[model samples]
Target: MGGTDCGAYRAGLGVYAIGRLAGAEAAELFAHLRGCPPCRAELAELRRVAELLAHCVPAREGAGRGPRTGASRTGLSGACAYGSRGPGRSR
Candidate 1:
């Protein structure tokens, strides 16, 4: 891959990164990255972005409950209870 091609691939401009890399294709991608400074830089930036996202945590605290009970427990007793009433019908 040349510079433009590498740029296209590195920018997430294609499907390569979206899928698993394997065997000779994986080797070729790595080889291209190894010899290409711009691709290397882009990969570093992507790694940084991934690291930042990996460390991100929710702004909220706990769920503020002991442990969910009742309908929440079985997940079968909510509005979609197994054999309960239909749409507008009450419990």
Candidate 2:
């Protein structure tokens, strides 16, 4: 929300932080980040969220150890289990 020009780049920041953005789009975002302080700040915050999300995932049972059970895997665990806390919110 820094500016109208930043909306597009901000939209992709989440994917970029998670290492999903690639090719021309990522290259463009990187270049924009160099000149856009607000985008850079948002990118840093998104990276933190990405890190927290990574740790919130539950480890797969029997991963390479044995057969998996019928238990469904939701992927979300720990911090994300209760849903997103959003910016500045806490448990």
For each candidate, what TM-score against the reference?
0.44, 0.60
Clashes of each: 0, 0
* Residue 16 local lDDT, model 1: 35
What CA RMSD would you report for each candidate? 11.2, 9.6
For all candidates in order, the CA lDDT equals 0.58, 0.79
How many backbone overlaps does candidate 1 show? Answer: 0
- The per-residue C-alpha lDDT of model 1 at residue 23 equals 72
Can you write out model 1's per-residue Cα lDDT over 1-91, one digit (the tens) per residue? 3534774346441223434556767677777876788776766766676557547954455644534556566665555653467656676
Model 1's TM-score against the true structure: 0.44
List residue ranges in candidate 2 displaced over 4 A: 1-4, 59-91
Q: Write the per-residue lDDT of candidate 2 for residues 45-82, one digit (tens) a residue.
A: 99999899779977786655753332224554545644
